[model samples]
Target chain A: MKRFFILSSLLLLFLAGCSVQHKVVPAGNDVPSQKYKMEVVFPKGEISGIMAFKRAGGNMYGTAVNEFGVKVFDFVLTGGKRCKLKNVTGFLNKWYIRRTISKDLPELLNMDFAEDALEYVNYRQNIKYKLILIKE
Target chain B: MKQATIIISFLLLSILPVKAQTDNEIIANIEKASKEMTSLQCSFTQKKQVSIIDEVITSSGVLYYLRDTKLCWEYKKPYSYKFIMNGDKVMLKSGNTVNVFDTKSNKMFSQISKLIISGVDGSGISDKTRFDVSFATKGKDVVVTLVPKTKDIKKMFSEVLLHFDVQGYFIKEIEMIEPSGDKTDIILTDRIINKSIDEKVFHIE
Candidate 1:
């Protein structure tokens, strides 16, 4: 009886971990190349920058640059489902932060790429990221 | 052979000092102009090019600067945002929200303030201890190219180029090149110098 109870508890823990993982759905990557105004709300304060996305080879590649023209990060979204981070700014290049962004950015991409505005919030980290397409 | 060597040496000696003098003369002119201007207002256009993605992002804004440390950079297109710095205090407004904090409180903000303030006021640009500064003539413009001597600045910018018109001697354009090969050009136009700017422009309190 003791052995069975321990086994069930371990299984329950595994299931809980799996359920916590966020889901990224595959969507069309037909978004045009454009620059989007980006605002990131951190726990302490907020930082703003610009995000630019270019679609090529059925994949969308994006780069974020700060207002001062510093490169923040680069990412590629495959089929709008999986996000692969190519580079990140030195301060935010941590593994945990990269993991969170990979999980969150695709969701923003999935939301009708043609939309003028999009936002994603990572509640676990309490970081809000917003993107607004800048009309030429 | 000795006669030819003397003639060649004479030409080199005569040409080198003139080139060196021209660089110093340009720097002196810029420094002098920066000191005379008490206040400045201008419209600026910033273009950032990312070579990796082959994208160019353009942002235009108005800049207000007071001689010492106060500056207001307001973006007016596609999005609305403002960064106002008055001494140690910095105010950032996005949309309707405003956050005021001290430069000492945030390291990043402090660094940004220093860069923008120094670039606009042309203070540290002439500091030989900080950068290996050189000058070149680009048609009617005098271009000063600075290579960072410190590792901290080198990490941010591989090279910085400041463009000045021969007529005004004020900084007309600034180009910063990053280690990643991306570059940004800020061009200032319609400059109004020595005009009285309202003190309220710097009021973030």
Candidate 2:
């Protein structure tokens, strides 16, 4: 299921280019803490970083690493079934700049080559180990 | 006026002749020299490199470290940046920009800082079990190198080199060379060791 969402995001990310705003809304009750580490391989490239989700009242406090592994923005996750990370890392000149992502998306967002692309990116360029734990 | 003063200072320093000891003398002398310092406060200059960019960025600032694991890494010249670590969270200030970081984000950097302070304080280095030592002398300083016999340390720095002054066992400089070849060199100049450093040095403004 996790792999499925990753694939879908990759597909939508490419087709939508810089304007896609798709995401997955978790089915479970509100979890205060979730340690989420994702490696997304787009048909065009790779996305890897850490995200720590702490339930702050109705919102989530998030901290993440940019595509370059540099520490970027830390912002509050508000509204929506799933909050898309919109320039959270806040790097001025990153390919992932202005990108919005969520855990759920439609099938058009999933591409068959996404897994392969992720592997290639991991092997060819950047290696990322990002940890984000959503707290309850 | 401030910029001119800096320029003139650099001009004078550039002409200063390099004075280093021979390899053997450095090794022998450094081996016998030892210090019982609890803390250090001094100014430093750092040159950082990003291989992908193939360029070096130089910065200068004041540094502080306690015998305990506390350290303040600051950059004041060229660019003003400071990283203050309390527990796992970090407050990173770049000039007028300020940022707060969650500790869990980067284990590698967090661990590296712990490793650096440990090496600087000597207590941690002496207590570590997997390091093999090699010594050499260079002009007025003794350079002692430590290679990790274990994999944990081999993950970051292949070897740690400490340059000690001949007059005092004081470490004048330290170089931590990562396995990937990227290295961080910290030159400790005009050190005022154990000179009642302000307790406020640890606070992030």
Candidate 3:
């Protein structure tokens, strides 16, 4: 019984440590569509791309393309909280990568931006995501 | 009748090889033009179709290339971004921040840089060692399809098609098809070849 309790406690700690936590607020009512220059940095390297987002009804949909013009990923942010990845490039379809993107992008969508340009940065799962507003 | 039949057979055999020879000649002419060209300035329109979202995004940009190895690809519509490749170095500018990378140190970037230059200059498209190339003549355009022979490129792109004008032997359009059925088509227009492009255009800062 003691061993079981200790193992359960350790497992809980591990799970908590691995969880993705980001402070998010409700998205503002602004332009219906925008474009950003996105960069995703991992320990090994960085991936640069362009992201286009459109808000319709209550959900925001985004698609990203690499500098070489390859489609990187597509996602939908619902209610400024729920982020569902619609598709990911074959090169970045790993489970861990998907989890981090799904967790971090919603928080990014919830943040406010300047009228002309602004930079937003977030860190999750040992990955850095930066989005710079380029167009509205 | 026997002599006439033999002559007809010989004529058909001679005509059959002409198409293959024409394809090779066209490729050679493009290579020769690329070799002689020193610089090029062009405007391009890129259209990407996202299969998952069922949407099409259109963007326009300008491309500048200097002989040997210098290129600047800049996006001006809907958003602003710049990619410049000078020799073994690459620079990317987004908003206010700029990042520089050494292509020699990064294999992926090195391949991409070379691919862009070759695609624009029409030099390496017919590389028998790197790609399985096929040609189809349609109207005044000769479409060259290149299937990647390397696993790394094959993983990213299923095939690439380059459309060249027969009269000028210059590339008109480039279509890259991904494995997931998504594709990006870039149409080059307002092309001015062998013109003096300012060296400052390729400057990193």
DockQ, ranked from best to worst: 1, 3, 2
Q: Runs in model 2 with CA error above 4 Å?
A: A1-136, B1-35, B49-54, B86-90, B96-106, B149-152
Report how far off residue A62 is in candidate 3 (Å).
Answer: 3.2
Per-residue lDDT over A1-136 for candidate 3, one digit per residue giving the tens place of the 0 to 100 score = 9999999999998776554111111234344347677787877777877787777657777788886678778787888888877557766889878888888888667777654443445543567777777643
Q: What's model 1's lDDT at B38?
A: 90
* Top-lDDT structure, candidate number: 1
- Candidate DockQ values, in order, are 0.15, 0.03, 0.11
Predicted candidate 1 versus true structure: per-residue lDDT over B1-205, tens digit per residue: 9999999999999999999898788878888988998998999998988654665778889999997989998887657778899988999887888889899988677766776666777765677876888888999998888887876667677888888899988888989888766788999999999999999999995
Summarize candidate 3's per-residue lDDT along B56-109 as a digit string, tens digits: 667789999998899999988756779999988899887787989999887666
TM-scores of all predicted structures: 0.84, 0.47, 0.77
* DockQ of prediction 1: 0.15
Give the proportion of true interface contacts each model preserves, from 0 to 1: 0.30, 0.00, 0.19
Residue-wise C-alpha lDDT for candidate 2, range B23-118, written one tens digit per residue: 445444433333457668888876543221222334578888765645777867543557666666666665475656555775545655666665
Q: Which order, best to worst by lDDT? A: 1, 3, 2
Docking class of 2: incorrect
- Alpha-carbon RMSD to native, per candidate: 12.8, 19.1, 12.0
lDDT of each: 0.81, 0.52, 0.78
